[model samples]
Target: MAPNKVDIRPGVSVLAVLRHLNYKPWFALAEFVDNAVQSYARHQEALRAHHGDEFKLVVNIDIDTAAPARISIRDNAAGIALEDFGRAFRPAAIPPDRSGLAEFGMGMKSAACWFAPQWSVRTSAFGEDVARTVRFEIENIVNDEIEELDIHEELEDVNHHYTEIILEDIFQVPVGRTVGKLKEHLTDIYRVFIREGTLELRFGGDALTPQEPPVLTAPYFREKDQPARLWRKDVSFDFGDGLSVHGFAALRETANTAKAGFSLFRRGRVIEGSGDEGYRPAAIFGSSNSFRYQRLFGELHLDGFEVSHTKDGFRWDENEQPFLELLREHLDSEELPLLKQAEGYRARPARAQLANTATQAVNNTARAMEDNLPSALPDIADAPPVDAPDEELPHAGTLARKEFNIRFRDKDWHISIELTEDPAESQWLVFSDVAASIERPRRLDIRVSMIHPFMVRFAQTDSEDVEALLRVAAALALAEVIARESGVRHAGTIRRNVNDIVRSALSEA
Candidate 1:
């Protein structure tokens, strides 16, 4: 049979070809940064033999949105040869094998097209004073149709020894929105490359600087002769004394939250943090024993996989998912016993303790007295002290006394407070823990019931004085609870729940 021939389309612009890529908005920047890093590495290797540290390969991004209206990426690299600049412009083309860091020659065209309709690149290398340039505009060549981009002639520049990709007529993209988004998405995506000092990213004057690796590293428990100890905690329980399970949990606190979540890292770099495919569903929650108490962090070392040319990212192909799942299952086995122990601990009743119950009672009385006094009322002359007889005052109401006993280690205390009501008075109930050990002291504890207070306060059948008294008492009790609880520092979750409870009561009334 004769050799088969197929007609090929001509004049397909690079933009038309790049549009076919599954280029999401977030991935576009990664592609561009990858190309920049490749250029930097090329520059570094060429100069490494010369043994001069004059100018390390770097990528500088200038974000100027004024009338000049441009963004530029300049790199001092073994730029494209004067001839290759034009050839580089076409779609589906790969760079020569000698290009160290750049692979998949399509990244340049695809990444540039995603950002703007018009973009150009200039390059220079090896004692060449003038660099070659290639310019292509997607909109002009595509004629507003979604088609491949065609490359124009590669022009040589005069006196410029480096490459600068200038993006113009940027399709009216929002700079603020773009920069803020790029900051978050690209930060972790490029973390490892940045850390290795193999790449640099600058946005105007702001830069994402890299940090040194940790001084201490944690073991995955699978390693032999562990270099340093990875901290682990064991938890067990005696629930009804019959059943028990043993589990353990460990954490290297620093690395876990360094990226804002319990990232499952492999080979000292992040794999799970950047890609969802690398994480097992079970790993979504930390170790079962640590759901509420701690976050589980995993670090694995895999040095053999091929990382993408961007240098900031990589993949393990089909092996990643199963690998993560196995790790998660292992962590669960180690955490079950601890989770059981924690569950038992949380099931127990919570207790509060305080010294000087008598003083607290007296303070409560004094606070009540100050609160009840009206601003217009003049001070009574030589008023009877607290010890004075309970003589009948002009006020017509029944006083309600509520008393409670709170117990803690080694002491006993009593607390009583008076509530005045013009209608049905408040009731009191008292219970004593006579068997309470000296190791457990019962102190006076009082809590005003909010549900009943609001119910009676707003009753339609109540007299004006009765309603006013109930309202005052409810408001006073609420004020006291707020003052005491707010003064102490504690978890906001409980406080928020309490506030919702009070609000519900008030709404019902």
Candidate 2:
């Protein structure tokens, strides 16, 4: 008997246009995995019985990079049934059921065409006696306006169920760094299924596994003596009209800026937020550098949300704001105040400590300071009378800039210091500050002048002398800000005295 034809005429030309669809490599690969998972779910019982009691759905993706590169993905699931073959191959044809991860029938076709000009799908459905293979030569089909494709079939065991898709002469094959990152994102996207024991996804000969971090369990920073409590909390909220969320929000036992933020899921797959690109809403996380952003992480399952065709993001339709408002209300409740805890908790970083040589250097400096303190300190450190008027700061042509942050007395401090070579500015140290409140971090901006007469005479040619002078200037600027914060009036007195005394008595010129 002659096999039935697959009509792919008018819509077949659309394959050329799909290649330009903005698709990240990881998201594009996920399309095949979604189809495999959906198929496994649709015929779980019968397929499980045929395989074994310990049967688990597995999907493997291989990327061949040598010479003529090719990509292949194979899955152990109920393949395209004979009845559904037409709709499956047709462009933009909706599936019979639109509730699963493969709801948008465009995933396979779009992704396949986006990846290569030629591809083939070979599959044997769960109960079907005949196995079939369908191949697409997109360029020939489009250029020649070909309307029909041959379906090659062969008799097969009725219980065998699997699908294999091979993309030949790959257009954009993943290579080098992309291979590792591709595995990471693919693992993250299917982490929920991996957790639930529903799917075992593999890529490049390795099974992808989830790497869940440990949650924090410590007393709040303010309540040091109190007993420790785990910082993981379950959150559930409804924004009315079928929009809802359920998940757990937590702080990592150790802070990791890159791995933090919410992973929004739908239909047992990540719709938004995977890998380092977690969904961090500014309303809740503030700046990306904020402690909340470095510590807070979660897995949120969204029940009543519409996902994009690519399944990479949700379609909010002006509902995102209200959804966030409710999410914040539920996650940041007064009783459990998650944002406060994330900000209040401080963990020391794990970067390399000072070496023995550095410690010895510090000890030598301290000893020298101890020996010189009595005579030098009394003359320079004595509290000077408040005489200099508070004056406006002068601007400069900045030559270098750097910044560092310090956590002290349970407050965040940002130090933005700069070096300036502008000869028009006579002052050695110029500073400005923004005071910290409950609402904002404290900021101190300092510019040390390198073209002052005293600096030019004493430290212009020696890098070591220039370093010492910069340290002194920065220390003096910091002391001024701290003294003003401590309610000392005319905080500029010490700087004014030092500037004048150095220029008059110590100036080599």
Candidate 3:
């Protein structure tokens, strides 16, 4: 009988698949770091034997922005052995055991392909005498030109053990800003490893540092009359199946949006929080008043929850629900009343910080104007009175622009002023209505055009006192006219007249 013949049809294009892998530049780069850290952990015994317990696991990321850009991640870890070359580069091969951070076995290849069209790895296993190399080209693979990975071997010292992944013709070169963002993301994601001193990660020669979450000790009540009492609780519970969760919840004396929310960690690495979801319980964050629990923040380590493939979030399976429900129960019974009391103690009508700052600034500017313009302005108080023409004094109606009796419907009007670099040729000042008005108060924002030739000339003076006075005068003058004529049909005419007066006064001063 003839040997059976089999044929398999290709399902997808390799490059196309990689192009849609959905890896952000930073997250893709993280995959390599993840592999290096895991390798270091797996070979801790060998590394210690060779370099002593003082040995530090280091991963360095270097990027070249020249034409045909390149990126390389080098790690001082137990490198790949010659025999494992096939598994390392294969698309879907799994490791012999599920240990360390190397799971699914696709991170390395997927990350490499996502970063560049061609890449190579140079690695030498611990105690090995030869270093192995494997190069991959997506173009070659997609075209079906390369049947197998071409491995190269080089003689090396037995003690040398390291792996360096070099990506050539990088799809995108990370500029300085992009690198900085990457450093921040990686620092947070791998904070646990960095904090424990198990791994030292560096980019452009600077080591990444971990950021610790702030701890809250008291309930945050903005009202000064009510003194705050710090409240905190330790939470620990089991979900059966050898799974458990443990952490602490605290209410602060001041509500901090930045520090609010639950930070969930898995295996010492933060997978969520600082704004990524999953730890919000209705009992804590579910009040009709969003800020009722904004003062609440905490961390919870899910002992048995599985993270998504991207490692950016949790799976949210049935196993995780028990812990969340238990947390909600505790918060509803123990913490809700304290939060409500803190809310009640808060001052009902609080003045905004910006308004207070603006008021203080205006006062200081008025004093400065008095000092600088004491002689600039004519002494009207001491001027001789001029005789009025005996032509019958015009009736009040003829002398006054119609008084509309405009009243602001809102109890408070928030006015903010800012300087912008608009061209001198443009309007000297502009006004815009600020959307998202603060509660109980309407806000109006004004921008003083700094690029106006008049402003530019004043700005070049020896001191900013003159410019500050001019800006404040213009803003106040304009605001006075707008507010006085708010309901008048001809308010635009009044605004123009006010602008002319302000411009003449500023120019003469």
Best candidate, TM-score: 2
Q: Number of clashing pairs, model 3?
A: 10
Task: Please identify model 1 stretches exceeding 4 Å from their true place.
Answer: 1-14, 17-26, 67-69, 96-101, 144-161, 172-174, 211-258, 261-280, 283-318, 329-509
Model 3 clashing residue pairs (backbone): 218-230, 218-251, 218-252, 218-253, 219-252, 219-253, 220-252, 220-253, 220-254, 424-452
Please report how far candidate 2 places residue 31 from its true position, in Å: 0.7
TM-score of each candidate structure, all chains considered together: 0.49, 0.72, 0.62
Q: Where is model 2 more than 4 Å wrong at Cα? A: 1-4, 351-473, 477-509
User: What is the lDDT of every predicted structure here?
Assistant: 0.44, 0.78, 0.60
For all candidates, what are the clash counts? 16, 0, 10
Worst 10-residue lDDT window, candidate 1: 346-355
The candidate maximizing lDDT is 2
Query: Model 2, 356-376: lDDT tens per residue?
Result: 222233334334433443444
Tens digit of per-residue lDDT, candidate 3, span 285-384: 7653355445566667778777776666778767555665787666545433444443333321122432333344444544543344334433321322
The candidate, 1 or 2, that scores higher on lDDT is 2
| Segments in model 3 whose C-alpha atoms lie over 4 Å from true places | 1-16, 219-233, 250-260, 274-289, 292-296, 319-322, 331-509
Residues 197-272 of candidate 1: C-alpha lDDT, one tens digit per residue: 6556675656666432232233332332455443454433222323222333444233222232333332333433
Q: Give the lowest summed-lDDT range of ten residues in model 2.
A: 350-359
